[model samples]
Every structure is written in structure tokens, then in C-alpha cells.
Target: MTDGLYPQLADAFPALASEIAELLRADGEPLAEAVADLPYYGPCTCTATCINLLTAPHGSSGSSMIQLERDGMDVI
Candidate 1:
């Protein structure tokens, strides 16, 4: 079985992971152990948050445009 959200989150956003770990540690649960207890299945398609965030367009001064450059994430 695959590791839980923590691993994917850590890999995708280390800064976020560190922040989350700090928060969890303050609650007396270390990140390593906490993540170990988390359940992982497969891709999540239950909510629009993920899809919206991935495909959302961002604008500055003029107009909005789809980002053409993502690290290694597939856009399809």
C-alpha cells in the first residue's frame, strides 16, 4: 500500500509539511508517527477543491490565463 497524504504533501510542499509538523508537534503528536497512522488509498475525486486549485487561472493586472508551467504535475 502507498503512504498517506503526508508523504505526498511533504514531497509536493516541504515548507507546508514543516509548518504542519510544527503544528502537530505542538499538539503532542509527532509528524512521523501521525502520518504512519493515516490511511492512504488512491487519487481523490470527491471534491472540486483539488480540481479547481489545479486548473484555476490567476491574473495580475490585465487578464487571467492558465499556467503553462507546473513543476512536474500533469495537466489534463
Candidate 2:
């Protein structure tokens, strides 16, 4: 993921160790108990807000922009 997409996770926890653990569990990937015991901080304040906007689950203004970016359009 881009740093811009997850600036919080990247800045706080470069590896996203906790989120990776959760995803592993959800995907049924066996992980060491110690791995799950690692501490993780949630998204940074700014990134938390961005995450909220990106994952509203109802409506999103940037969805089109995201799609355009995914389609290789230069938003800049």
C-alpha cells in the first residue's frame, strides 16, 4: 500500500505487524502465538480520519478518484 494510503500505519508501525496478524487469522493462516502477542497502535490521527473517509461503507467522494488512479490515470 502507498504511504499516502496508510500514512498512519506506515509511520507508527512500518510492518503493520498487528494488522498482518489479524489478516492472517481471518485468512486461516497459522501464526505463532508470539506473533499475535506483538503490540500495535491504531492508525495515526490524520490517517484514521482518512481511513474513515475511504471506508465509509455507504458513500464516498473519492471512490471515483481511486478508480481513476487504479486505472493508471495521473490524478495530479
Candidate 3:
């Protein structure tokens, strides 16, 4: 992870670091990998947002594939 990413994540969602780390490890999919594999051309209109590889070129697809849910509610 980049230095900027950690700070950004810490600021955006303070409680999700551990959860994110676990997911990344369990699936053996790092953030960069997830971002790279994301479907750039799709009919997904979900308003959620995430930081991934596509953002580097597509400049914020205005949506996120990873939906952070907590207590039965979507957090992201």
C-alpha cells in the first residue's frame, strides 16, 4: 500500500482497516489487484465508491464494486 492510501483510508473509514486487511489476505487479492480486475465496462449504477486501479486511468468511474456493509446497512 502507498503512504497516501493508508492515510486516506484511515481518514475515510477509521474502523475498516482491519476488515479490509483481512479480506485482502483471505482472498489473496490486494487492493491493486482488485482494482485491476474490476469490470471497467459494465452496467453497474451503484453509487458506492472505492479506490482501485481503474481510478488511475478512468478517473473515478463514479461507482465502486466493493460494498462495505455493517449491521445490515451499506457503509460505503
Expressed as tens digits, the lDDT of each residue in 1-76 for candidate 1 is: 2334333444555564455555555556544344323332323455645543121113213354322223455332
* TM-score leaderboard ranking: 1, 3, 2
Q: Which candidate gets the maximum TM-score versus the true structure?
A: 1
Which prediction has more favorable TM-score, 1 or 2?
A: 1
Candidate 3 regions with alpha-carbon error over 4 angstroms = 1-7, 32-59, 62-76
N/CA/C clash count, model 3: 0
What's the true lDDT of residue 37 in model 3? 26
lDDT (Cα atoms) of all candidates against the true structure: 0.39, 0.38, 0.43
Better of 1 and 3 by lDDT: 3
Candidate 1, after superposition: displacement of residue 70 in Å?
30
Error of 3 at 38 (Å): 16
Candidate 2 local lDDT, 7-67, one digit each (tens): 3332455454455555555546565233434333342345434542222223323324211
The candidate scoring highest on lDDT is 3
Residue 64: error of model 3 in Å?
A: 7.9
**How do the predictions measure up, each by TM-score?**
0.37, 0.25, 0.33
Count of steric clashes across candidates, in order: 0, 0, 0
